[model samples]
Target: MSSNKQPVINKFGVISSSYYEKLFKCNGQNLYKSRSGKSKPSYSVTRECILKFNHTENLREKERLKEQLTKNILRCKRRLGLRTLGSGKHVNIPGGWIEATYLAQCKGDIQEEALNVLYDSLDHASFDYCQLPALFFVAESVLYRLCCDAFQKTYLYSVEMKLAKIGYLVFLRLFVFFLHGHLGGFKAHLLRLQQYLNVLSLSEETYYKYPNIFSNVAFILKTSEIIYERVLLSESTFSPNGNTEGYENVYSDMEFQRHLRFNQGGYEVNHLLWHCVAAWSCVQNNSPKLNNVLEHLNFHKTQLQNKCWLDSALALLVLAEAAKLNMVCLKALMDLVRDFILSIMSAQNQEESYKVNDFSWAWNIVYTYVTILAEICLYAATSDLRKTVFIGFCGCKSSQKNISLKDTVSEDEPVLREASVLGLLKYFSSKISENCNQLIWTGYYGLVYNLVRMSWELRGDEEQNGLRNTIWQTLQKTKDHEKDERIRIAVKIAQAELNDPTDPFTSYGTKVPPNVGDETLSKYIGWRIANTLSKLFFPSIDACAVPLKKLSIKQVQRKYPKKKEDPMKKRVLHFTVREHPSKSELSMFPYPDLFTRVDEQLARIVDHHWQEELKIRQKEDAICEAEERKDKELKEKNHFKEIMKKREEKLHKQTKPYELPPRTEVISLESKERNVRKVTDYRFSTKIVQLQTGILKLPPSAIQ
Candidate 1:
């Protein structure tokens, strides 16, 4: 509520402040304090340390606690999977999967309470800590499971149905957490998880399944460690016992098996998904591995028919990756890409709501498609990017084609001048109009790179200079108004690439010009392409740019009717905290939303904290002002004292008498030493040559 620039810290309204204060206060204390002369449970110790790690005010203390826990886990692993007290007492919390079972058994209120505890603990975890990413992974997995449960029970109209909605909020919060931390270390988890599942095989099921079945917690811990290693030491080593031959064997033989069923729970899908990801990871120019993956992916195209949205999104990403590898002919792949885009766009149109669930994979799909489009523009053969095709193949409406730019070719031409460029821009602009900020922000960088690259590649109307400028200006506005620092930084980097002269867009310092050597430029281009696509799955802040429109501004305004507001009409809907009913008064209502009450209470706490913070700020400002005034007076007094000292010194100097120089005497030199020294000296002789006289005579004649 206050305009002050300081952060507001609300005092706890329902929960006591000491609850959090005690967490921070017990930074280095042993968890098993002798309460009634008996030590506490292992879970208690773990929870206490985790809380301390989460809330400790001192960075050094937080690190010490984190290192202590890490050491404990490492020691437990080293001791033949036995928990022990080596340097200090340690505890092992239940793994995410095991915890899920316990969560399922808990009653509704207990589950909500437990979720809140986990939320608070995970929310406050140090962003830079090595363990935070794995923690987020576990937390998200658990939250997803909870969400599924709530969704399944929603039809029953039980109290638990309301709890399901909280999962989405938790998901949003978790996403915001990553945004704040720049999604630190999560990429490695993604990569490692992909690698682990990629090499897993039904043939070696016993090896992988035994540990997971018997001791799931340890398995989870081991997986977390491997992921952390992969993230922290990416180039140091590779996963041992990868099933390259087995994966190929399964891909080749599994489709024809008589007993093969598509209903293998989520395994078959996950297996395929991981393989696609791994193949994408291992992609190289004209790679045989990529070719094989593409063959397998083509075989499973039918399997993609009934898959869930998340799995479909993964398959699409793999397809985009394969496209980048140039595994197939451009024309055929372009048609496939266009058809897929059209299908997704169609699905989006048919959907009535653009809620979180409906738009879950929207960003990922757009990101992948944009990346593929960029790749086509950059790396496709000259014939591919510039080849003219019937406008029907691109799925653009006739009206869109009719609205032409000033320099565009005639509509009677019957074919697109640059089919790929026109199609990609039209689709991109439509998607931009949908107001999916996450999708736009994620894909904006790659779009910029492609636009600049295409601007260099294409000339005249096909160059799309106006669209490029508009998109860049849109991103500029988003960057200026965006709240999330991570997104702002990413936008700034993208802008630097597009607008900064010294920042060569490609890593190899390849200038954005045509006819550059492809070998060096291609590698740098490949990296930018890959990195641009990778950051899209993560989310970010919304944009403030005008919605992209297919029609010209003048035409659009002409089509729609404008209305003037009546100043006499009164507004109907309004809310104020003062108008809210007290808890006692609300108890008589037949149905009351507890969630709304909690939200209002939290808001009240925030307002109170803001007012308190404003008062503190005002006090601090008054103190500063007094100090400044005192300092000013002191400085003036010093200046005056200095001036007076100088004047006194000047008067003292002016009052002093003049002085005179003393007389001195000079003595004459004696000649006795000159006669004494001549006794030991030898005489010197000199001679002159006769050739000089001849030269002087010749010179006089020459002058005349």
Candidate 2:
């Protein structure tokens, strides 16, 4: 049988090839049949029947049916040893009573047993069968019970479980898909869970009454944390030559395959770490035993540095709630805020990671919130502590940009740099603005406003005037260059605060005000100075002094020409071929006295020009040498082609020919000389020639 063909069942009940293909296309029909044939309906079919019955009737009728179904589910769940109703025990029930009991109990009231059954379905029942309709029935039951009167007491407890179970169900469903290689499904499930949580609001009574449900909330949070951690860890592990050390290195030798296997089958363990903190915070807010909850929160803070990603956001939310409730100590809350800001700064410096694109924007907004909270907290604290906290919070340098004088001088600094500056300004501005408003509301506006009024009155000195001018120029330049609305607003606010006589921080009542004649102008001048100094020292302590020599416009223009037309248009004439001097040419040219004078002058000019040309050529050669050195260093550092020369050398050596011997002649002579003794003449010939009288002497010639 072809592999692609469907399988067929034989008389013996064995699945044949023809039936396999048919079953494959039947949407898990073969598994359903096999399970049913073994004497029980598949969970899927049972769930389907329940769903069909659920939608066929009104709410009261659905509840009646749900009670019956719940009994059957509980029986099946108990048979599988699943925990129900938080009892940590399995309830045994007859199969016949399960469905009928669930429907009867669920009618017009939340059935705790039905909720137990639903929770069990989440835990033990097959998701393919139990997920969708189970969530719908559970949601409907909880929603209805929350509104119903008779079930209020029981409803609260069961509803918490139901909501939590639904959350877990959604999480698990996502987990299953993620494990099954469907990332989109997992994301969709996560989004749905988020939406559900957004709509969910627990009454204070419910929150305190069911604190244990916080565990489920924690589970949801832990799921998101785990997923994010897994992704980070996976990326780190697979990264080429990635440094696996410290906490990250712990997974180096761990067998991911086995871990993946366990996690794959266990989808119920989807705990989102952030959800846990959020739940705990919720409980802490409503719980009467606030001290204990706060203590518990402090303990959880230790885990935050390692799982800082979500914890930071949670901490902010918790602090915001604390502010709203007016439940926490000002000092303690400020400490938390301080620690959070420090952590964020450290993380930004160490990781260069952004939870959002406009980190500066986010930072400023969050800091503004923190400052506002801190201001309120400060007012709640003693005067000494308020000052300390105020200075500490405002004085902390921004991580995005170093506060240095150079940065202030350059208007075109990077966005982060500008953001850092603006962040500081915003912080100070918000503090003063809020304090001013408070003062006004509290009837201390006259005292506070006069203090700021005094600062402006005192700034009539020449040095202060210059400082003011610099500041005004800087602000104008920044206003022109900055594009972000938040930064621009912040800058405008800072500028206004500096100029406003009622600016509480500056205007805090003083002993005396400036002379009336200079008050208005001095205020303007003082603002300019303060603004300049603020920009110069913002985010950093570095101060840059403008160079004195380059300060004047004429000096700058003299140093750098605004136009190069004359120099650029100047042309030089050069001889294309060298002219040779000849005596005939000179005589024919008949040099005149005027020509002689011109020739002498031209000769001097040529000599000077040649010397200058030689000097220029030398400089050009030096520049070329420097450039070559730089290029060589760059290539060596790159390293890719460095081994090519050695490879070529090796190939050449292998292919080289061996050296040959010098040419030689072989001498062969027949038997000779000795034959003369046998009557054969042996001749030894030696010839000497006599030269003519005029010929050169041969060898060492004897006398003729």
Question: Global lDDT of each model?
Answer: 0.38, 0.36
Please list the residue runs of candidate 2 whose C-alpha ends up more than 4 Å from where it truly belongs after superposition: 1-75, 78-105, 108-110, 120-158, 161-194, 201-210, 218-704
Q: List the RMSD of every prediction in angstroms.
A: 35.6, 39.2
**Against the hidden true structure, what lDDT does model 2 obtain?**
0.36
The numbered model that scores best in TM-score is 1
Q: Model 1, stretches more than 4 Å misplaced?
A: 1-336, 352-357, 380-421, 430-449, 453-493, 497-499, 502-704
Candidate 1 lDDT over residue span 1-704, tens digit each: 11232112122101122332222112233223333536442221233444456567897996676566545433323221122211112322222212322232333333343443333222222222222333444433443343334334423322232222223223333332332233333463344333323332221333221111112222233333443443444432211112233355555432222112222120123344444543555454334555565555555543333324334444444444444444353343455445555544455656663342355434444444454565454444443232222122444444245223323434443222222544554344333422545443444434443444443333223344443343334333443444544344443433332333442222322434432121111222223223222222211123211111134344567888588789999889777767886777665433435544555687798889999999999999999999999999999999977776786687754221343422221111234455555643422111123344453234567668
lDDT by residue for model 2 over 552-589, one digit each (tens)? Answer: 34446788977656755778776443465565655543
Model 2, residue 406: C-alpha shift (Å): 60
Clashing pairs in 1: none
Q: How far off is residue 249 in model 1, in Å? A: 17
